[model samples]
Target: MSETAARAGWVEITCEGELREVVGGPNRHAAHKTRTALHALDRAWLAHSPLCFIATSDGDGSCDVSPKGDPPGFVKVLDDTTLAIPDRPGNKRVDGFTNILRNPRVGLAFLLPGRGDTLRVNGRARIVRQAPFLDGMTVRGHRPALALVVEVEEVFHHCAKAFLRSGTWDPDTWAPQALPSRARIAKALDRPDDTLEFLEEYYGPGYAERLYG
Candidate 1:
């Protein structure tokens, strides 16, 4: 079948009536949104979550979502309205920091493994590369070189329907997976010398020891 004919059943909801027809009304819990700071429950969730996905947009409207992971409480809750995340050592892509520099607005989704509910925070953020704050986020005696300081504008707990439907926390649903071999990727992109095996050999057994900056 032609592509257009194959997609004929798809309806575009460009008008208000067509949009409302699918969802059928405003959210029932719209009034539950909390603005200005983290509530007690929000604080607890942040304390226990070891990972979160941060979303940011450039001034031109291009966007990126990046994962931040460390030990639980790696994201410090400075106060009801403030929090900080240490920027640990990595390949130095700086996509997230660069985006924050262009546009400070960001959204974070905190996830705890085996826990269905997730915490969401949206706010303004700034990249901080100072001694005192960076030193405070030290892991295994190695301090982070930079930090992302966030001014919490809103915090809320999201229901677990999505996770439940996907069986994210169910062990039986998980299958063994492996990282895509960087060697193949490099060859496909026209560079065969830079490979996964080369990187692993270069990093050596002490690679974990050098993770922190």
Candidate 2:
């Protein structure tokens, strides 16, 4: 490695004491984590959450996070201890699923529009491709080929300090702009072959029909 790169690495925090010195520890309540199969409040929160981000780590310690969103209640409560999230069609990278296969531990954060607080779920997860499970998650006649079965290990509600400071749920705080076309994004990457029309057609209103297995 270059001298600068090697010198940069030497400045990294090597232990908790060094890290805590730079950034102080959390408050007492912040350190207290809630653990439950599923509380009633958690069930209600999950029922209305249409978006969630899940983080997982591979066996070799590599990490990946994937966003999953569908209609409200897309993630079903199988029981107090379990949750079922349909694997919707996407770019098919499957990073989250692949990570779960190697390391079952996952951290999930569910968000509902207009709500400042978020629901957090941490658990062990497994990918299920059984017909029965897949068929149950069918949307518009499109059944998912796979679903994630998450066994709840810890469930809690995260406070809205970050959202409150950022005004995430406030429309007035948002800047007016249209969604960026994939062509524009491709151009930024020096790829000229991706067309705006193709991206528009692929992600337009009718794109909902393609969200099946």
Candidate 3:
């Protein structure tokens, strides 16, 4: 549809008051659940989370979200108000790191497989090139060259309503073949010059062996 036709009948919310009027206010617990420091429960949650999504925005307001994962407890809890996430092998885009250089503010969502609830953290972050704590973050004999350290500003546990509604953890609802395979998609969108056989071999079982290499 044309821009004007697509926007037709759309009512924009201009202020917090107007938005709140439509969604209503939170209850006392929801309003007061945010904490400036990590509680024991929060620390425990971080210990068991193997994956997290980090959100960052550059000075120009360009945003990026990157997933960081490893064995459970890969994220280190330095203190009640600090956390350190080790950098791992990846595509080398470093979009999130580039954004952090321009803006230190970041938001993180930690999740555990098969669990619906998640832990949310918002804070100012800094890239640490080297630290004594980095020694303890080693995994599979590979130590990270850098880590992202965050100073806690807000911490809270998010409800599982969204996950439950989508049946995210229910194996019965999974449809892995619903879309084209990764190799096919990559060939069509990113690696058109490569053969499908080569792409499939590149993404096959051996792919997991290169995680820390």
Candidate 4:
């Protein structure tokens, strides 16, 4: 230990709450949040976004972030302040969806490839299965297992730094081809071929026609 530096109190934390916006440069005028800024169902954002990440945590604070991707507008805007996202088939852990059952607090980050700005939605969610909503979506004639209904708390657009840092829009930065395919992934799990192939194919086209139609 550096006794001299420790005695000087160099590592001091004020622990004060503050809003810092250093990256966007100094604001001559502070812009307070407005209804326009806090959009519920902005068609433009949904139209551009084909992917989003959903973050949820359980009562114990254990967390899961699931990557959700489909055609643009796959997430249906039920009203000015609510969104209906179909619970598509997957590996069946249902971690994120289940977490929301215990704790409604959730964070959604909507992403559009090749675009700089992205939509961020923070909200509380509830699971629902009903007539209009249930009838609104289907998968290969089969209906959605369930749907997550999100009550918008706050919504905003963030700059491109996240995409730039992740190189999400760059084809060269993509994951290597040797990464496991669904068939290969399923093989590793020892699941049957019929189920795996159906799921693999269902993930894209099946998903589009199912939810977006």
How many clashes show up in model 2?
0
Off by over 4 Å in 1: 1-9, 15-17, 178-191, 199-209
Q: Write down the lDDT of every candidate, Cα atoms only.
A: 0.85, 0.86, 0.96, 0.75
lDDT of 3 by residue, 20-81 (tens): 99999999999999999999999999999999999999999999999999999999999999
The 10-residue segment with the lowest total lDDT in model 1? 176-185
Predicted model with the maximum lDDT: 3
Which candidate achieves the best TM-score against the true structure?
A: 3
Candidate 4 accuracy as lDDT: 0.75
What order do candidates take by lDDT, descending? 3, 2, 1, 4
Cα lDDT tens digits for candidate 2, 1-213: 988977984777899999999999988887886877888888899889999999999999999988999889899899999999998778878988889999999999999999889999999999988846666677878788888999999888899999999998888888655655555665556456757677667657777666663
Tens-digit per-residue lDDT, 1-213, candidate 1: 999999999878899998888888756686666667888888888889999999999999999999999999899988899999988878789998999999999999999999888898999999887846676688888788788999998888888999999999998987644544444555566465676677656556766667774
Q: Over 4 Å off in model 3, which ranges?
A: none
Error of 1 at 68 (Å): 0.4
If both were scored by lDDT, which would come out higher, candidate 2 or candidate 3?
3
Give the least accurate 10-residue stretch of model 4, judged by summed lDDT. 28-37
TM-score of 3: 0.97
Model 4, residue 180: C-alpha shift (Å): 6.1
Residue 155, model 2, lDDT: 89
Q: Return whichever of 1 and 3 wins on lDDT.
A: 3
